[model samples]
Target chain A: DAGITQSPRYKITETGRQVTLMCHQTWSHSYMFWYRQDLGHGLRLIYYSAAADITDKGEVPDGYVVSRSKTENFPLTLESATRSQTSVYFCASSPGTGAGPQHFGDGTRLSIL
Target chain B: QQQVKQSPQSLIVQKGGISIINCAYENTAFDYFPWYQQFPGKGPALLIAIRPDVSEKKEGRFTISFNKSAKQFSLHIMDSQPGDSATYFCAARTNDMRFGAGTRLTVKP
Candidate 1:
């Protein structure tokens, strides 16, 4: 496919374990975002990157880490996974911050026990 | 704090009826509004969008009503169908895009 894709569509890990979810896009977008969708709370941004090596914290960044070493890849890491972190994680990319609608991946369903 | 507020967490509309989802934002800087639709096991995709410059925009059976003064926007689906059953999210874009809590819409056939 030509759009964005997330690895390990479904993941399960224990609390305190280190887990990384991978996201890759073929569009070479300048902006990439990571968000977690939970019941009642909707979707909340976790982290985002403006460009390669330019990542920043989002609304809920605690317990999560992200790095954008390449324009096409942005990976999110849970340094110490917690049960509270169990949610559907979505990765999206936009041509730029002020550009058009963002394109989202299939999303990674992560379960922490 | 929630930047955008959506009403009626869940909605059920009879087929061929109108389905409306409303949202309000607190930020005046937000200029762009978009609605997303998501099905089970699928990612949300842009359904429709509107800019502050326009009061309304329609694409086929979907329409977006924007009120810049009230900082409110809404999505209206005409002639709703079973295919329209999905989660809808409204988002506003300022320096960043903030999404609403989302509405689970069911179009009963």
Candidate 2:
């Protein structure tokens, strides 16, 4: 497809297990973002990459790590997933021109028991 | 802390009625404000947006009203329909983006 896509639409892992969510976009956007959507919290940014190898922390970056080795791929990893981390994760991309609209993938629903 | 605050955690409106959602922010540095709509099991998609310089921007049945001095903005969906039922989020952008808690709207037929 020509849009953003996330892998393993649904995932389940143990509290101490490590899990990774993959995000790939064909648009080659300059900005890629990872967010977690939970009830009553809307969407909170976990991490974002301005460009390949250039990443920054967002509102809730603890316990979550991200790397953008390629402009088209930005992956998020949880070193030790916790039950509190169970939420729907979304990946988005933007052209990075001031205030450009972001294109989002369907999202990955992760559960940690 | 949530930089953007949204009101009316949930809303219900009859078909053809108007649906309104409000959001407030304290950061004057945020120059762009955008609203996103999400259906069940799907990521949010940009619905409409407006800049602080503009008071109002309308596209189809969706409208965004911005009040720069009050640090507030709103989304108004006219003639709401069942298809319009979804979760809507309002966000403010600076170097990073901050999103409101979100509003779930349900339209009754």
Candidate 3:
């Protein structure tokens, strides 16, 4: 409730379907990020937001879309889910874009079949 | 291409022993290096961090040894305990952050 929280701790969906993963932070951090973790690959950033209405792509943002309408909410949407997109997604927030420590959410385990 | 590379995908150690995890980075612009610890079913939390200007930083029983020339850094846990068993991640940061593959450490009780 006080820190960042992600919705749908577990999710199962089919290919070519649209799915959205939600992230909310109570700290109102200026920066928020989304990452997908896979075996051996670690955590690859998908998208990041510097502030409300501003978002940018990260290393693995190809199939993912993110929007931050409000400072407290950043949701990641899979336009067309694919099997390769199945992974544990984590949301993080930081006060600024500097080298500050980021706070991470518990993460959402998404499975695409 | 991976910007950060980590080793010993997994490790096992006895209680009271030392646990070491190494990481290497190719980027010189990285100004910050941080280590994160993650428990099962939980998100990763920052354990220790160091700036490039500092070669070594110690906190409690954990230490970070950094080599600026070699662009390498390591995390050492002294007096390992079963409670320390978890996945540890090393990360480097510039304008954005890049994380290492991660190492799963298991300290036997």
Candidate 4:
């Protein structure tokens, strides 16, 4: 079904450069989220959108920007990326919050050099 | 509280054995507790989940035990298998959400 897909499955960027990770879902879920996974921190939410054009900050939103121009697409942009931003980024979506389970993407392994 | 605490940073179990992972939270408003399994190079996928109103829920070889009063929950894998080996994360969802540091599980055949 290609339920959820994330692009640039692997990315390597230099510090201070802008990098964007793409996420798309075919289910047309109402809630989409961006999370970064680190060794000791587990998964930390970066940004979330309730629906198109309705976005909110998450636990770890610094240095990252997100927009849901369409219900199926939510992209995360790391402005002036830093080494600290290097982590496995996961995109997830749920039919609704606290009610339905979130489906996750394979994730994008981003390396900020 | 927004924190969800998990124990045993890692676990090893033999096939046909039982594997359990525990998580505790401080928020009483959290009604949804879910466990996710993540393989290397992949995203975390829902393994099992439970609601506070229910004390336990089971699916196939996986089960979730919830203790609302204690603000704790756990995932139990019966008849552990090698394919079940993965990093497990416990998450509590309220109006806001938080996740526990994952536990890496290794099942030996």
| Candidate 4, residue A103: how far the Cα is off, in Å | 0.7
Each model's lDDT: 0.91, 0.93, 0.93, 0.90
Output the worst ten-in-a-row residue range by lDDT, candidate 4 chain A: A94-103
Candidate 3 docking category? medium
Error of 1 at B37 (Å): 0.5
lDDT leaderboard ranking: 2, 3, 1, 4
> In model 4, what lDDT does residue A96 have?
88
What lDDT tens digits, residue by residue, belong to model 3 across residues A7-105? 999999999999999999999899999989888988888889999999989888998999998999999999999999999999999998775447999
| Stretches of model 1 off by over 4 angstroms after superposition | A99-101
Give the C-alpha interface root-mean-square deviation per candidate.
1.6, 1.2, 1.1, 1.9
Candidate 1 C-alpha lDDT tens digits along B40-88: 9988898888889999999999999988888888999999999999999
Clashing pairs in 3: none
Best by DockQ: 2
Please rank every candidate by DockQ, starting with the best.
2, 3, 4, 1
Docking class of 2: medium
Candidate 2 accuracy as TM-score: 0.97
**What is the docking quality class of candidate 1?**
medium
Leading candidate by TM-score? 3
Residue pairs in collision within model 2: none
